[model samples]
Each structure stands twice: as C-alpha cells, then as structure tokens.
Target chain A: MKFKIASGILSDGLKKVEKVVNWKHNIPILQGVYMECTPDEITLIGSDSDESLRYHIPVDGENVDVVTPGKILLPKQAVELIKKLKGEIVLEREEHILVIKYGKKSQFSFVTSNVEEYPKLPEINFDGPSLILKGTEFSNVIRKTAFAAAENDIRPILMGLNIIANSNELIAVATNSHRLGRVILKKGTDKEKQVVIPAKVLEKHLKIFDLEKDVNVYFGSKNQVVFKNGSLVLYVRMLEGNYPSTERLIPTEFLTEITLNRLELLETLDRIGGLSDDGKTGVVKLQIRSGVAELSTNHSQIGKGIEILELQEISGDNEFSVSFASKYMMDALKSIDDDYICFKYTGNLRPFLVTPSSGSPEIEETQLILPVRERDV
Target chain B: MKFKIASGILSDGLKKVEKVVNWKHNIPILQGVYMECTPDEITLIGSDSDESLRYHIPVDGENVDVVTPGKILLPKQAVELIKKLKGEIVLEREEHILVIKYGKKSQFSFVTSNVEEYPKLPEINFDGPSLILKGTEFSNVIRKTAFAAAENDIRPILMGLNIIANSNELIAVATNSHRLGRVILKKGTDKEKQVVIPAKVLEKHLKIFDLEKDVNVYFGSKNQVVFKNGSLVLYVRMLEGNYPSTERLIPTEFLTEITLNRLELLETLDRIGGLSDDGKTGVVKLQIRSGVAELSTNHSQIGKGIEILELQEISGDNEFSVSFASKYMMDALKSIDDDYICFKYTGNLRPFLVTPSSGSPEIEETQLILPVRERDV
Candidate 1:
C-alpha cells in the first residue's frame, strides 16, 4: 500500500494485532500481518486458524495520506522493525516490491508475495444477534471463569467454558473436574440460549479489548463468535460440543462455615503449602478448633509447617479436618475480593466453596474446590 | 550456628555469593551454603569445585545477637526463603537440624548437612610479592580486554588474557584468532613478570571489588594466580601453555590512517550492519575517500544498504577496499574512548588496527582486526 503515516500511531496499532499473529507453518501468510490501506483508514489484521484480530487506525482525520488503496502482507520481522522507527514513514508499493522511507535513510524495497496467495478470511456477517456489555465487566467474567477450564485435552468438551444467556440471567461456568469457577450477570430479557466457547481462543481474543467502551458480541450457530468495539474486531470459533453437567457439583448444604480475612488465610495456606511432599498433590490440611484454624502440611523429608489463622465463627463442626490441593485453594482464595472470606463445606470429600463474606445468598460469583482423597493419619 | 540477624542483611550477603554457588548434582554439600557464626561476624561461604566465594557480615553493630559460635551447612533453598522473610530471623543448630524462627508466624527447621562434609579449598601460600591497582581502574581494564578472549575451550590457553607487567607498563592482550584487543596501562608501575589470568574467573572476581580501595594481584608459578584484598581471597588457576604472539599480528606500517568521531562512526556502522547477512560471515564494507566515508552491507537476499558519512579529512594511499566482521568492528569500537578514532591499515588482508587519535604512541590502546577474505561481487 502507498501511504505516509505517523510511526507512533501505526506502531501502536500493529503491536496490538501482533499479539494474535501466528508464526506456525500451517499457513505461511498467517505468519505475516495483513496491511490494508484504504482512502479512509489502514487496517492491520493478524490471526491463526482459531482466532483473529483486526486493528484499524483512521487516516481521514489525522496527519496521514493514502496515495492508493491497496493491500499487502508485511513480514513479521520487517513490520516489527518499522514499528520501532521514529517520525513519519513513507510506504510505496512498486509492482512486487514495497519500499519504506523515513528521514534521510530509505530501506530498499522488499519482495512481497501476491495478495491472492494469502488465505481469505470469511467476511463475518455482523447481522447476527448482538449483546453489549461494559468491556471491563465482560473481561472480568472471562478471566474469572476461564481459568477453571481443563488444560488437558482428554475430554475436549471440558476445555471450553459454558456461556448460557437466559431471559433474566447470564451465567458462565468453567470446570476442570477438580475445580470450577462461576460468574453470573443479570439480564433484562427472559429469552435463553447456551453456547460453549473454547477457553484458549476466548482468552487470546480478549487481549485486544482495552476495557474502555462497551464490547459487542455476536454469534450464529456453530460458525463463529465476533467481538468488536471501536476499530477492533476479534473473531473466535465456537467449540462444537455440549459442556459437562456441573449443576450437581455445587453443594446445597454446609456443616462448617467461617469468615476470615482473605489475605491472612491466603498467606497462611501459602506458608503451610511449602511442606507439601509432592508439588502437584499439595494436600494442605485445615483443622478448625475453637476460633482458630491451623493450616498445615506435613512431609517426612522437609519437615512440617503450621500456620494459625483466627476465624470469626466456625460452629457446626467444632473440630473438623479437611485436605485440599494447595493450588486449588490458593486460586479460589485469591479470587475473593471481600475483606473476609467464607468457606462452606458439606463434608470432607464433597466440594467446598469459597466466597466473599459479604456475598449475598443470590450472588453467583463463588469459587469451588473439590477436596482430595485422603487416608486418615 | 546460633545467632539472630536481620533477614535483609543475611539475604544481601547470600546474593553476592550466589553467582559461584554450586548448582550441579555432584557433591550434595555443595548445594548448601556454609554458615559460620561468631560473636563479631557471620561468615557465609558458597562454592562450586572451580569457584568459591566467602562473604562476611559484621553483626556486632547491627540488630544481631550471637548466643553460640558454631558452623553448619544450610540448604540454599532454606537460606533463600529465610532471605525473603522480614524481621530478625534466629538461627539455631541442634544436632543435624537447623531451626529458623522469625516472629510467631514463621517457624521453619531444615535438616542440615555436616559442615565437614563440604570440600575444602586449598590454601595458596602467599610468600611472593603483589601489585595493587584501583578497583575501578582494574575493572575497566578487564572489561575492555576480556571480550576478545576465546569463548570456546578448544584452545584453553587462548581463553585467558595474557597480562604483561613491567616496571612502567601493564599490557593486557586478548585474542580469539579473528581479532585481538590490546589495552596498555602505562600509568601503573610494576617491577614484575608476566601472568595470564583466566578471563572467565577474572570477570566474576572483578565484581567483588569494593570500588573504593585498590585491589592486589599476586602471581606464582605452577599455573596459579591469587588476588587478595583485606579478608577476601580469590584464587584462579592460570593456563598451562604459552599464549599466542599478538605483537606479531599487529602491522607496523600503515598505507592509510584516517581519523573520525568515535561515536558517529560506530553508530553509522551499526545501522549499516543491520542489512548484513548473518551466519555466513557478517561482513560490512567501508569505503573511505577524500572527505567522505561510505558504509554499506550487501546481503544476497535482503538487498543492499548504504549510508554516507561526511569526513573532515582523509589522508591515505589512493584507494583500498577492505571488509571485517561487523561484530569484531562493533566490539573494538565500543572499547575505544576517544573523540576521534584513528583507523590504520597496511593492506586489505593484513591485520588493521584502530587507536585513539591523540598524543604519546606508547600510551595508546590499540584494537586489531583480521580482514575477512575477499569474495567476488
């Protein structure tokens, strides 16, 4: 494309899209960023087969000039080098070569492959139904629930987070068998539908959102989902499968529930976890007696660690012992925002839930961790 | 060891000695730091078979108390964790266990190995004489000359920098066959012999300099050298064989000698070198004419890049074209400290030299580079 653009502005746009650029050999063109210069704006697109990002910088109201509306695939390295340059850059396309000139230095034209050689991404029809939510709120829902998705592909369905939007409620749930994270949002209408989005793809797509304005989401059938706001468009393919039934995983009763300062409990668990025999099977034991909870981990080789944390109230089970994977407990505890955290458990083997102490009964933002199987000591 | 010291002080001392700490799986005790506690000072020693570091921290004036004088081996991980902690940490040794307590929250005890199990470094008797130089000045000399030493151990002798010290001058020379960097310290006075010090050991040892005081160097036969200052003793084993003759490599007569601003020429070479093909021989071409110098690099695939630098004056034989590895040029250029850089050459294939454009020829530090074999364009 023939154009003269501000280096800083173009660099900012290219960097945002570069995060999505795939360097895999499956599709060589995908390794390069797509630069399309129109009379009004210059769009930069980078993507792999699963997710794609499109960032545009408007030249109509800025100090930019588009001599010709054209398209080209810029090599990843060249694009990065040009972005790091200063001042204004003049881009001129002469037949198969693209020459860039800035200041008294001019880098000779580089050979460019024919635009027809690049794979054409389907023009997503934005005519599909769309929903708008605050960028920050949408990002929070994705991050909080997405982490619970299964990293192993043994069961492909477990790798996707279930997103269900009903008439008056929108719920998101993710589980990796041992742990699950859920977040809920209130909706205005009563209509409903369910979809499973690959957590890996969704996480990569959300990186382009600056969390400024409202982000719009649209999807149709098993085709793809589109998120756009301002001059950026992120498209992700929807996973084709039904999510596992997590409704039964939630506990409806609790024998022991107590509220303790979030930081204190997290720090105590962290210290006790140091003595875990094997890092992965980090089973931290929690013994609650009176108003103090002694969190500890005992290892024959590295000695044991015991940390006492004061609790406000731990009634039902006066003195109970339960063990959990250290990582699961730490992740759940970190997500609690309230000054005090409440841990509810039905039994030692059953799933235990952690939520903000100030959380309302109707609130859906709660972290759940399934206790590990333990032999009595 | 029985003592109570501020966690920050202990951590800082440990970090300084961490570079030489054993990370291999050979001697189990090598993975642990030796802790010796005295009423006045706490000495921490860490070592690999090849390198050893002993750091002492005075506790008499600090928030420290010594209840007993003892020596014990504490695992590196335990020491690192204690360092991460705050407040005064008490160290108590009972049998083979080391109990570390800080506040009421931290009570960790690690199994310690017997201090006697660790390998003891041989004491080098210092009956010979020694020379001292300011720490900063010595460090600068090492930095300027060390990079030219051979990185690979193919020629063990070349891996060390040959140091020749006479009554009036201390000459440091390092070469990797491709290029040689010679720095002359005419300011120093010594009635001494020549000694070759391993570049790698010297590099690590130089960091221990106090920056305020002068460092002493003592050399002896049997391929051994010792550096001592106050309580710190650093010993390095010298190379077995003779070093290459660098004096014969430098050309005595030059057909051309041109002077230019050091920084300006270096920057121009850097920019032009970007276009030079890597791996096959990174050769950047420099063509100097009357009052003008052209820097260029021709890459078979990436086209050519050329930049013209205006020269104040150029006095040499009619015409000459030569090319050297860009990396060697950059390394030599970086070490020169001069407003004007003087380039001297006898012929295209012969070794050319670069020196500061100034006074006494004997005091000048020279950088020599062997020209790359010329190929047909």
Candidate 2:
C-alpha cells in the first residue's frame, strides 16, 4: 500500500485503533494493523479475537494520493513512529519493506509482516436495523452504567451490560453484585429487543465516535454487536449467558425520602469517606432528620469523620439511619446532570435508591446501593 | 492547641511541606506533620531522615487566631480533610482528640498523633556565613544538572550534585558514570566553598523557594545544610563521601565539529531513536561527514531509521562515528538555552561534549556522553 497523508490525520487514525491492538497476542500477525488501499479509500484494521476496529480514510481529494491498491500488515511500532513524525508522512511499499519518508530530515524503512499470514475479519452480513442516539447522550449513559459492571469475573453476563428496548423506552442496566445503575431513554414505537454487550468493548468504541452527531448501533441476537458512525466501525462479540434480573433488586417505595444539593452531598460524602477502613467499601452512615442530613464514617485505624449537610427538604417523622458504600453513592450522583438528588431509603438493612430530581419519564433512571448492616464500632 | 484559620491558607501551607512528609515511615509518628502554635505565628513541619521543612503562617489580621500556645501532631488524612473543607477552619485540641470544624457544614474529630514521639530536627547553628543566589538561576542550574545523578547505587556520593562556589563563579556538576551535566554561573562571590548536596533534597527545596527573589543558603561540614528565605526554612543533609572529579572526563580536542539547529537535531534524535531496541542501552548512531549529519538506529528485532540533518559547518576531514544513549543526549540538549548547538567529538571511544552555540560565558554549560563500543550482530 502506498499513500501520502498529513501527520495529524495519521496520528488521529492510528490512535483510534491502537487500544484494541492486542499487546500480548500469541499470533504475531494479530499484533499488527492491516493497511489496505482501494481506488477510493484507505482502511486500517486492528483486532484481537473478541473485538475489532476498522477506520477508513477517504481519498476523494488530492490531499491523499494513493499509488497502489494493495494491502500490508504494519507492526505496532511502525504506526507509532509514523504518527510521531514531524511533518507530512509518505508511505510506500518497496519489495518487502515499507518505506516511510517525511521531509528531508527523517526516513524510516520498516519490514512489514506477510499480509497473507494475518487472519482476515469475517464480513458480517447481519445488518440489523440501527438505533440512533445523540453521541454525547449515549456516551453519558455508558459512563454512568459501565462502572457498575463486574470488572473481572468468570461470569460473562456479569461483565456485560444489558440493553432492553421497548416500544416507548430504552433501558440500560448494569450490576456488579454490590451496586446497580439503570438509565432510561424515551423513544417512539419500535420492536422490543434485548442484548448484552461487553462493557469494555462499548467503552472503547465510544472513544472514537463523534461527540457532535448521532451514533448508529446494531446488534444481532447473541452473535455480534456493531457501532458505526463517521469513518469508524466497531464490532464486538455478544455475551451468550443470560443477564441477572436487576429490576427485582431496586425498590420502588421508601420509608424516608430526602432531597439534597448534588455537589454538597458529594463533597460531604468525600470528606467522611476518608475515614473509612474498608478498601472498596467505604461504609458511611447517613441519618436524615429535621431538614438536616448527618454523614459520618469511623475507622479503627484512621479515626472518624462527621459531615453535616443541609437538606433542601426532608419528609420523615422518625429518625432513620442507613450505611452504604461511599464510592458507589458518589459514582451514582456524578452520573446525573441535575442540581438536586433524591434519596429513598427503607431502613438500615434494606437497599436505598438514588435518582435525578429532573429526568425524562421515558428514561426510568435510578441507582441502587445495598445498605451495609449498621453496627456500633 | 486551638486556632482558627482560613481553610484555603492552611491547605496551601500543608501542601508546601507535603513532599517532605514520609509516606512509608517505619515510625508511625514520622508520617505526621508536627503543628506548633505560637502567639504570633503557626508553624508546620514535615520531615524524613534526610530532609526537613518548616513552613510558617503568621497571624496577620485574623488569618490565624491563636486560642492557646501549644503543639500537636496531625495525621496525614486528618490534615488533608481539614484542608479540603470550605470557609474558616477551627482546630481545637481537647486532651488527645483534635476537633476540626469548618462553617456549619462539616466537623471532623480525630485522635492526634503524639507530638513528642516525632523525631526532632537538630537546632541549626550559625556555623557558616550565608550565601545568596538568584532563586530562578539556582533552580535552573539544579534542573539542568540533577537529572544526571545516579538514582540507585552503592556509591552515595554519585547520587549528589557537587556544588562549588568560587570568587567569580558557582558551578554544579552531576554524573551517573555513563553521562554527566555541568552548569556554571557567574556570580559576585565573597568566599570560595565546596559542598555536595543530595539531588533529591535540592529538587524538593526548589519547589518552596520563590523564583523571583534570592535564596540564602548556609552549609557546614557536619549535619545538614539549610536554605532559609522569609518564613520558609529547608534543611537538607550533606553527602559524606567525596564526589568524582568530572573535569578529567571532558574532551579537550575534537576530530569533527559541527553546528546545527538545536530543535531540529533534538527532534531528529527522538524519531530515529524510536527504532532502537528497548532497554537502558538504547543507542543511536551518528555519522557526520562533509556538511551533513545522519542519525540512525538499527535493531535486530525491530528495524532501522535514518535521518539526515543539515549542518551549518563541519570541520576535520577524517570520518568518525559514535553511538551514545539517546535519552542521555536528549536530557543534556534540553538544558541548553540556545538556538544552535555545537557537538565536539574527540575519538570513537572518548567522551563527547555538547555545548550551546550562543557562547555565553556568564552561563557555562556542558553535556558529556560516553560512546558505546561497536559490535557486529
């Protein structure tokens, strides 16, 4: 393959696919990005076994000159070197070496891997009907829910996020045993469908999608899921195992409810959480009574902290106290774009629910955290 | 101990001495910062074994309101919590427990560390007369030379930068056996002296010193060297061993001398160096002949890179080649404040020198890198 491209354009393209390029691939060819040039476009493909990314650079203008319509497998280091060059980059295949020239200052000739040795990604024919969502909104939903997915577990379903679509609404849910996050979005009449996509795969694809425009998403049962927008196509394998029913875990009613400024609550939790002894679980006790909420955490090793936050409204007659993970609560609060947050709690041992004060009814968004057993230390 | 101070001011003071606080101290009390409250000023001190810092905040216009003159040690977490709080911070010590209150929003109470258990720094006696240097220039010199000091070695002196002050000039030199950096400054000296200061201590002290003013430095044969200016005093222990004589390592004669733009040469080395094999000994070859200098690096596993840099002038007819650690050269070149750089080479195995073309005697600087022996793979 031969082409001339700007350094900025090349760097941008290489970075988009570099993360998916397996660093420890047993197959040497799998570690390289496949560069193919056609009459109209040049494509760079990088993949492991589970996920793959294909980035296309259109050669419609004279800015990008394509000399030959061939293919070559370029090593990871070659792409990095080309991206780091000072000026316009020129790529040419001379015999077995790919000669990259830039200005009169630098010239690098890197030996390319055999194009035939690299495994070609299968041409997936399942063009499932796509759903369009604002790129920023989709990104925000993924950011809010993906963190609750199990980071490393043998249970494949726990590592994936379930997306359920109905005629009126689309719901996204993710749970990692301790915490669950659910986001809802309103839509017109559409066929109902459900699919589990790996959280990591969706996150990587989101980084490449244009934040200014809408993104198209497609999925085919338990086979594969695809996200395509602009010049990038991201394909991910679907989780085969059934996801746990998360709807039953979140409570719909509460014994006590309180409304507090989101930023103030976040700050108070952060301060009190500093004294927590548990590594991942920062058990902070919250007692809301008489338009005031008291947050406190005591650790045997680091001492204790007490933070008093003013409540906007409290509608509880009797004093109630509950303990939950501080980090989980903070993460849930940060996901919503509302000034005020409403907390619904049952007692000291039951799960507590948190939701944005203002959100669309089509989006049934709520975050749930299981309360820790209250004990005097 | 009781005092009311602005939360922002206390946080700034704590951060000034945070670097000196030992995070992994074997003694628990050493991990805490000692706080002393006087009628006029409040002092915060943090120290490891090698270095100690004392930061003072004067009670001016109610910025600090002292209720009692006492001293206490606050743990890292407690201090950080108090610092992050908003509005005025009140510290009240009742027996062993310290209560910290800020506005009406937060109140944290924690057990204070035993102030008596913390190690006490030696009382600095006026043994040597004070010497002054522009804080900006001293910091610049240290920044340029400290990178060459050995990070980990049995030879303790090699980890320190040698500082020599004569009647006319002050010079700092650092070497890690493989490479060396020397920075010289012209000064109106009153006395001549020589001392070796640990590179780490010099680096830490520079952060607290105001770059716009002059810093007063005092040193003695035993114990610690103190840098005091205004309300800040930084004490750093001097190295016991003798520093290596670096004057003998600089080459006097050269077989080839070339002048080139510093930025172009720096960037060229960075790109070509990417082709070198990974390790501490990543060598990039340089060949200077006629009026052009070519930089290249070839690895058996990766590939090769060649960059041709235009030279303004080239002396000596004989062709010469040398390979040095690219990182070391890059660090040395970054220290020079000049548009052009002059490279001086003696022989294939001799140490080479790099100097700025501006030829400012007021700021004399030199970089030395030893050549690696050529080998056939």
Candidate 3:
C-alpha cells in the first residue's frame, strides 16, 4: 500500500481509532491497526474483540493522494509515531516493511504484521431499527446514567445501560443495585425495542463524537450495535442477558418532599462525608425539621462533623431523619444541572428520589438512592 | 483554646503547614497539627521527623481574635475540614474535645491528641552565618538543578543538592552519578560555607514560598537549615556527608559544539525516543556531520525512527556520533529557559555538556549527560 496524507488528518483519524487498540494484547495482531488503502480513500480499523472503531480519510488531490491500492497492519508504535509528525506524511509498503516519511529529513521503517491474522470486525446490517439523535442529546443521556452502572462483573447485566424505546419516548437506565439513574428523551420509534449496551462503549462514544453533528444508531443483528457519524463508525457488542425490571424500583409516592439549593446541599454533604468511619462507604445522616435540615457524620477515629442547611421549600412532613451513603447523594446532585433540586422521601428505609426542581419540559430525569441502616456504636 | 479567624486566612495557613504532615505516620501524634494561641497570634506547626513548618496568623481585631490562650493538637481530618469551610470560623476547647463552629449552624467536634506528645521543633541559633536572596532566585536555582538528584537512597549524599558559597558566588549542584545539573548565582558572603540540603525539601519549598518576597536562609549549627519568609518558617535537616567534587566532570575542552532551537531538538528527541527497546532507558543516537545532525533509535521489536535536524551552527569536529538516554536530555533542555541551546561534545564515549546559547550574565548553569555504550545485535 502506498499513500500520502496530511499529518493533521492522519493524526486525528489515528487518535479516534487508537482508543480501541490495546497494545499489550497477547495476540500480536490485535495490537495493530488494520489499514486499507483504495483509489478513493484510506480506511483504518482498530478493535479489541468486544468493540471496533473504523475511520476513513477520503482522497483529496491537494491533501491526500493514493499511488496504489493495498492493505497492511501497522503496529501501535508506528501509529504513535505518525501522530507526532508534522507536515505531509507518505506511507509505502514493500513486502513486510512499511516506510513512513515526513518533514524534510525524517523517516521511519516499521515492520508490519500479517494483515490476514487480524480478526474480522462484526458484520452490521444497515436495514435495522435505526434512530437518529443529536450528538449532544445522546452524550447527555450517557453522562447522566452511565455513572450509576455497576463497575464490577459480578452481575454482568447491571454493568450495561438498558435502553428501551416505546411509542415516542427513548429511556436510558443504569443501576448498581444501591442507586439508579434514569433519563427519558421525548423521541423514539413507534415499534417498541429494548437493548442493554455496555456502559463503557457509550461512555467512550461521549469522548469521540462531535456534539454538533447527528449520530445514527442502528440496532443490528447478532447482538451488535453500530453508531455512525460522518466518516467514523463504531461497532459495540451488546450484553446478552435479561435486564432486571427496574420500573418497580422507583418510588411513585412520597410522604415528604423538600426543595433546596443543589450546590449548598452538595457542599454540606461533602464536609460531613469526610468524617465517615470508612472513606469508601461515606455514610452521613440527614435530619429535616420545620424549614431546617441537619447533616452530620461521626467516626470513632475521625471525630464528628455537622452542617445545618435551610430548606427553600418543604411540605408533608414536620420532621424526619434518614441515613445514606453521602457519595450516592453527591453523585445524584452532580448529575442534575439545575440550580435547585427536589428530594422526595417515602420513609427512612425506602429509596428516595432526587430530581431537578425546574428543568426542560420535554425531557425528564430522576435519581434514586437507598438509605443505609446505620448501626449505633 | 478559643479563637475566631477568617476562613481564608486559616485555610491558607493550614495548606502551608499541611505539606509537612504525613497522615499515615505510625505515631498518631505526628499526624496532628500543633496549634498554640497567645494574646498576640495563633501559631500552627506541622512536622515530620525530618522537617517542620511553622505558620503564624496574627490576631487583628477584624480578621483574627483570640478569646483565650491555650494549646491543642488538631488531627489531619479536622484540618482538612477547616480548610474547606467558608465565612468566619470559631474554635473552642472543652475538655479533650475541640469544637469548630462556622456558618450559621455548622460545627465539628474533634477529639484532640495530647499536645505534650507532639515533637518540639529544633531550636536554631539565628546568630549563625546567614544568606538572603529573592525567593524567585532561590526557586530558579532549585528548579534548574534538583531534578538530577538521585531518587533512590542508595547514595544518601547524592539525594541532596550541595550548596557551596565562596567569594561572591552561590553554587548548587546535584547528581545521581550518571547525570549532573549545576546552577550558580553571582551573590554570596565573603565567608565560605557548604551544606547539602535534601532535594525533596527544596522542591517542596518551591510550592510554598512567595516568589515576590525575599527569603532569609540560616545555616544553623544543629545541621539544620531554616528558610524564613514573612510569617512562614521552614526548618529542614541537612544531609550529613561529603559531596563529591563535580568540577572534574564538566570538561572545559570540546571536540564539537553545535547550537540549535531548544524546542525543535526537544520534539525530535521525543519522537525518536518512542522507538527505544525499553521505555525506561529511552536511548537514542545523535550523528553530527558538517551542517546536519541525525537523531535515531532502533529496537529489534519496535523498528527504527530517524530524524534529520539542521544545525543552526557547528564548529570543531566535522563528524561524530554518540548515544545517550533521551529522557535525560529532555529534562536538561526543559530546565533551560532559553530559545536556543548549545551542545558541547568531548568525544563519542565521554560525557557532553548542554547549556543555553545565551542567558543572564549574573547566572550560569550547565547540564552534563554520560553517553551509553550500545551493544551490537
């Protein structure tokens, strides 16, 4: 394969695909980027079994030119070298060696791997139930819900975000049993569908996609999903398992509802959380009476911390107290973008809901946290 | 102890001394900050076995007020909590508990350690020989030479920066045997003195000292060096050993001298360095002939990378090649704040010198790197 391309174009394309390549993979071929050069454009594919990223650079006589059409597997080291080069770069293949030349007097000779050894990317069918959404909208939903997904594989289904489409709403939900996050967008297909995608893939998409563009998501066969935007396409393997029914996990009624400044509550929680017995659990107690709320935490070794926050508005309950993981509350508060937030409580032991006091009319989001049973010392 | 102090004042003071406190120390008392309140001011001291930092917050009726004179040892956890607080904060001691009050209804009760268990800071004789210099000047000297200090304690003396004062010049030198960095300032006392200060302490000082102020440095008799600036004082134990004579390591004669843009050479070295067999060694070869210099590195498994850099100016030997660790060269180049850097090579096997092409006449600095012998494959 022989091709000439602008340094900037190649660098940008390499960066997008490099995210999928694990250089230390036991299979040497899997540690390379498969490059195919044609008369029209150059395509680069990088994969790590579970996911694959394909990026294309079209041939433009001014910035890109193709002298021959062929394929070669370039190692990660060469990819890194090309990314750091300036000016136009030329790549020419001779047998098993690929020579890359750039600048006035710089050149690199890379030993290429056998292209035939590279695993084939999953075949994705274009004619499937597809949905189109703005990149920003898709990224927003992922950021809101992905953080709640289980980080371990003890329960593989919980590590994925369950996406359900019905009538006119597209809902995304993620829960690690202790807490849950859900976001609903007011746009979807008439045909109902549901699929659980690994939260990691959606999170990675947030970093690679251009927010100004539109992304086309296709629920392809063989448990594979494809996201295409401009000249870049990403294929992710769907988690094959039945996701738990979480609709019943969300509380529908509350005995007490309180509204307060989100930032003030977050700060107070952070201060009290420092006194938790164990830094990991970060449990704190919240007591609401009249219009005042008190947050406190005590540890035998670390002392006690208390903060009093005045509620902006309160209803249904004159007094109540509950203990929960301060980290969960902080995470829920942070996912909200509104200046003011609302907290709904059914009882001390039941899971409570946190939502923005005021948000967009078209979209709805909710966060739920299960209170912890604190043991008296 | 009872006192009211502005949050910002207390936070800033805590941050300065907190650097010296190791929270994971086996001795519980060593993890606490000793606080002493007198009628005039509040003194906070944080210490590790090797060093101590003392910060004073004077009592001004508006910003600071002392209600009673006493002493207490506040735990690191409480110190962290106080740093995050806003508005005015009041502290009152009742029995063994210290109550910290802030905002309208927030308070923390910390169980204080016995103040008598806290180690006392070394007493220094201020009448000993002392030197004064601008904080920026001291910081610059440290920045230029400290990185070359040995990170491991295999050679205890090499882990410190040797400061030698003679005539009107103050010189700082640090080396790990393989590489050396030296900086000289054109201001010193007539009396000659030498001391090796731990590089870690000087590096920490860089973050705490205000660059605009002048720092008074006292060489105390107890093998301790004290740096005092305004209301802050840092006491560091001097390393006890004889520093090696590095004068012989810097060659006055050179077989080749070449000058080039510092940034361009740095980038080229960085790019070629990526091809090193082992990332840690990062060895690269430089071949200089006439007006051209070629930088290259080859690894059996990673292939080869070569870059031709144009020499802005060259003299002496017409042809010579040497191999050295790219990381050392990069560090040396980064430390020199000059647009142009000069390389003076003695021979293929001897150590070479790197210096700024042009710099302040009052300051002189030089970096020496030993060449590595490459084994033929």
Clashes of each: 3, 1, 0
**Tens digits of per-residue lDDT for model 3, A1-377:** 89899889988998999898988887888888999999999999998888889998999877999999999998877887888888899999989888899888788888888898888877766455378878878887888898899999999999999999887899999999999999999997864779999997788767888878888888775788788877888888999999999999999999999999999999888788877544435788888975799888888766787788989989898698889998889989999999999999989899999999987876789999999996442
Clashes by residue pair, model 3: none
Which runs of model 2 end up more than 4 angstroms from their true locations? A125-128, A154-156, A188-192, A277-281, A316-318, B125-129, B188-192, B279-281, B375-377
User: i-RMS values of the candidates, in order?
Assistant: 3.5, 2.5, 1.5
Residue A275 alpha-carbon offset, candidate 2, angstroms: 1.7
Q: State which candidate, 1 or 3, has the greater TM-score.
A: 3
Tell me the whole-model lDDT of each prediction, alpha carbons only. Answer: 0.74, 0.79, 0.87
Descending-TM-score candidate ranking: 3, 2, 1
Rank order (by lDDT, best first): 3, 2, 1
Q: Higher-lDDT candidate among 1 and 3? A: 3
Task: Estimate, for each residue in B1-377, the C-alpha lDDT of model 2 and write its tens digit.
Answer: 89999888888888888778876698777888888899999999988878888889998747789998788888877777876677788898888777888766567777777787777776765444557777777787888889889888778899999988888788899998988989888874675778888987786567778778767777654667788766777888888777878887787888778888999888877777666544233578888765678788877677777888888777875467888878888888888878899899888889988988877766788888888885332
Tell me, by TM-score, which candidate is best. Answer: 3
Which pairs, if any, clash in model 2? A184-A363
lDDT per residue for candidate 1 within A171-244, as digits (tens), equals 88999998999988764333366888888777766776779977777754556777787778887777777787
Q: Tens digits of per-residue lDDT for model 2 on A1-377?
A: 68887777767878888768985598888888888888799888888878888888988656677877788888866877877775578888887788888886577887877887776665644344557777776787798788888888767698898988787777889888888888888763364778888987786577778888766777544477777767877778888778888887888778878888999898778777776544335689887766678888877666777777887877655488888888999989988788999888777788888888776654557888888887553
**What 10-residue stretch in candidate 1 chain A is worst by lDDT?**
A273-282
How accurate locally is residue B257 in candidate 3, as Cα lDDT from 0 to 100? 92
lDDT of 1 by residue, B1-377 (tens): 68888888888778766667764548888977888888888878777756677777877755877889998987754665665677888889988888887767657776767788877655555544456767766776787788888999999888888988888778899888988888877655454777777887887767776767766776655455766655555656677688877787888888988877888777666655655434223577777765567666666565455666666446777467788887788888888776788889788898888877873554557888888876443
Judged by DockQ cut-offs, the docking class of candidate 1 is acceptable
